[model samples]
Target: MAIGDSVKPAAFQYHAPQSVEEAVQLLGMFASDDGRIIAGGQSLIPTMALRMARPSHLIDINGVGELEKLSVSDSVLSIGACIRHAAFHRPVVGNPLGGLLSFVVKHIAHYPIRMRGTFCGSLAHADPSSEWALTAVTLGATMIAESLRGRRELHADEFFVSIMATNLAEDELLVETRFSLLTPGTRFGFYEFSRRAGDYAVAMALVTFELVGGLIADVRVGVGGAEDRPRRLPEAEKVLTGHPPSARLFEDAAAAAAAAVDPMEDQQADAAYRRDLVAVVTRRALERAAA
Candidate 1:
């Protein structure tokens, strides 16, 4: 069925620009009103179908040149806004942050959706259960957004405001995301729970740590699907940061993370259940990270 068939709305303007500059100008021109930028059309299309978003103008950015490049530099990996989830799973990418991100992307929604769901699209969509957002936050990534006015950068912690909310301006477009290169001693792990394999996560955990001389030197932990936005577990990280990776440390970190989150009771799971799941998955991920 057609999108308009599902959600009846008046036809609006559609423009597919060939360059980022052109798109920026178009956005500037329509900045006064309800204008939406469409990249992969994965999230926006569905929202439009459901009548949740009805923009007066649709600015398509797919044709913009060089927005799909995935480049790895000496200290960072820069992923363009248009890079799809499938691109992330390519072996040639040589992602050193463990297979956690690739595993999550490979299972997101299904093959058909993964084929079209762009990396930035998922970030921009800012769904609480989105693996891309969780992974980025866990890795201490940066998001780049641009507009006719200028450009701005946001750390993963500052980028996501709430569920389905972001720090992006209405006229700005997310152009790239940069992830720090994993150090040689860094260890990584990810875990998520859901009713089905391809379904959105009910609770997810990501952990990155470094082992120096058999001791934990640094640690970062992030959890998703348990709150309105993905969040780092600073208390949990502290519990593991300077200590040896032991069963006791993992347990303490998990308990700290569970106490830190404020999950809401939804149809998927109760608040208490999510809090418990956070502890469980945090422990599991920490175990894997320390292995």
Candidate 2:
């Protein structure tokens, strides 16, 4: 059955392809000012249903065989674009990232949603409040995208452009995401504050640090759900990079994180509230990483 017939209003034509090459060709066929690619129908389906997004053609990639792998290597973890959130919750798949990422994934939206939502789908949707986007950016992950022309790799910093927007082209498909494994002796922490569990986070913080002979060798921190986009706080990282992790250093990092981010006011929180959360969450995350 046609998607228009299945879904009311007949907003557009739909094509489901069985292979990546076929999907790419279908995308090319509908290469116009208003064509969109659909995967998992987790985010795009809802948006289309609301008519918030109206594409002349919907190229469904669910039947494509190339986008469903998750493999780990010596220094990197590679996940295909279509790998579902439930797949990520497996012990083998989720345990390596210090168990912190796994904790966050368990709280994303709901079980039914997680069962259908794909990691790359979440990243491509580019919701700043999304756990996947927030965590990936904090960890300095890489995103691989493919088009009829070719494939390109983008660092997490360059992949997300704004709220609900990304660097992907209309005809391009996100193929995989890669994350560099934290070095040995690296301490890691991930924390987010929300009104209740399983709801969108008000502010989220991720911290990674390397301790070299009891002194800090490197540090990185990222904050999300409190701004227009997920962002790394290099200033905060700089403050703690060489210093030993302590209460004073944690305070300094918290101050730096607060100063670095200019969060927007939303119905859930005000600018001042979000700024305060940045400090609180950053401090807690640093303390946990230090521990």
Candidate 3:
């Protein structure tokens, strides 16, 4: 039977490919057309159990050695899709991005779950509440995708579309991600509000700013869980671009961010509340970055 015909989270064939080429071939053969990539399985497994996602095949890349690399070359950091969130929870020793990643991963979930969650999987899943997505938008990360045809790279802005969605094509496999190194003197801050410590965030904000002399040389503000996808607040950033940091200025900028967003009401939060939370967290994140 064709894979797409199987619904109800029914039994699925599993394939463990030892290399990217093999994985790409398997994806082209069955998984990509109607199969799912099983990397961390932190999100996909639960969805499958609930029958929300009923892919007919599971393509496992756990044994793909090259897909597990973490390295920095020529100022670009490339992280394999299969790396566990736990490995990123602490400073990566030599990589500065490690510090920022560490800050975000801590709020992903508790210890055990983090040990099984993949950074690229979160990127691929494109959860609006995902800290990875927020960071990707804030930092303008790039994603690398491979297929039997060829390879393609997409910027963060191009990759994410909406909640629980991404631009990744069905026959393509996310291999790794590349992040341009932040300039020296850049400061970053993040804040999120969730019902509980590990619950998905209701509203999240993150910022990166660099001060020169007495003025803000550059600043970027982004919010998630307040819209369909992670949103970069260029209007708010504009307010702080060359201005000196102050409480009133930050308030105005944060207000702009809140006003610019269109949030949705769900069981966890109302649209109004999430909007307010976005303002609060945006302000807090800016303040933290400025300090």
Cα lDDT of all candidates, in order? 0.85, 0.82, 0.87
Writing each residue's lDDT as its tens digit, candidate 2 over 187-215 gives 77777899986888899898887888787
Write the residue-wise lDDT of candidate 1 on 35-92 in tens digits.
Answer: 8788888878877766788888989888887797788788778889888888757543
Q: Which stretches of candidate 2 lie over 4 Å from their true place?
A: 1-10, 31-33, 93-98
Q: What TM-score would every model get versus the actual structure?
A: 0.93, 0.91, 0.95
Off by over 4 Å in 3: 1-9, 93-96
lDDT of 2 at 20: 80
Show pairs that collide, candidate 1. Answer: none
Ranking by TM-score: 3, 1, 2
Residue 54, candidate 3: alpha-carbon lDDT: 79
The predicted structure with the larger lDDT, 1 or 2, is 1
Clashes of each: 0, 0, 1
lDDT of 2: 0.82
* Over 4 Å off, model 1: 1-10, 98-100
lDDT of 3 by residue, 203-232 (tens): 989998888998887688999888989979
Maximum-lDDT candidate: 3
